[model samples]
Target: MKLTVKEERCSGCNVCRVVCALHNAGAVQPSQALLKIKGEFPDPGTYKIAYCNQCGICADSCPEDAILERDGEYNIDYELCTQCLICIDSCPFDVMVVTESEYPAKCTGCGKCVELCPRQAVLADQG
Candidate 1:
């Protein structure tokens, strides 16, 4: 499953962030969102959507074997996670973010954020 985020249509209203936080952490705050939006102020702002690309870098970089590549995707075993921040630092996309939950949160390809996005910015495509 590949998640695609189209930035051209994003309004930066933060609907996707709210949805992500709600789905992953059962909260309404955008700061808790796994996905992040970075942009500057003013008209014609260039938005950057950050989310896990489902890449296996974190799993491969883990020395503790806490991260695993399962069914072609990476998943972290919370019980085994020592909060080392290795995976968070290893993410090239800067998608893996340290949330209020302590451990980093990676996109689960759940499509909840995609569905809740008002701008239709995020999408889950399985090939």
Candidate 2:
């Protein structure tokens, strides 16, 4: 499964970020969210959503074998994680984040971001 974005439908409301941070990290911090929105106002005037595509580059790059796939979803096994940033660097979209807790944060394909998008700009499905 992959999370797809419809940039044109995004209103910059940031609901997806809020939901992601709250659902995954139990906080309201956008910086800790797995996905990010990048753009500026009154110039290009477009918001670009960046998120995991479940490409497995992170899993393949992990020397500790911390990342694993289960039931078609990629997840990190925190006990096996060595706080290495290899997965973070391997992410093509730069969506993987290293939290203040020293754990790497990647999408679990939970669909929280997609479900909370007010504009329906984010979608998760078998791609």
Where in model 2 is the C-alpha error above 4 Å? Answer: none
Estimated TM-score per prediction? 0.85, 0.91
lDDT of 1 by residue, 1-127 (tens): 5578888877777887787788887888777777788886675578888887787898877778888787777778898988888888888887776878688778777777788788888887654
Model 2 Cα lDDT, one tens digit per residue, 1-127? 4688888988888888898888888998988888888776889899898888788889999999999988767899999999978899999989898888988999988899887788988987645
What residue pairs clash in candidate 2, if any at all? none
The lowest-lDDT stretch of 10 consecutive residues in candidate 1 is: 37-46
Best by TM-score: 2
Candidate 1 versus the native: TM-score? Answer: 0.85
Model 1 error, position 43 (Å): 6.8
Candidate 1 global CA lDDT score: 0.79
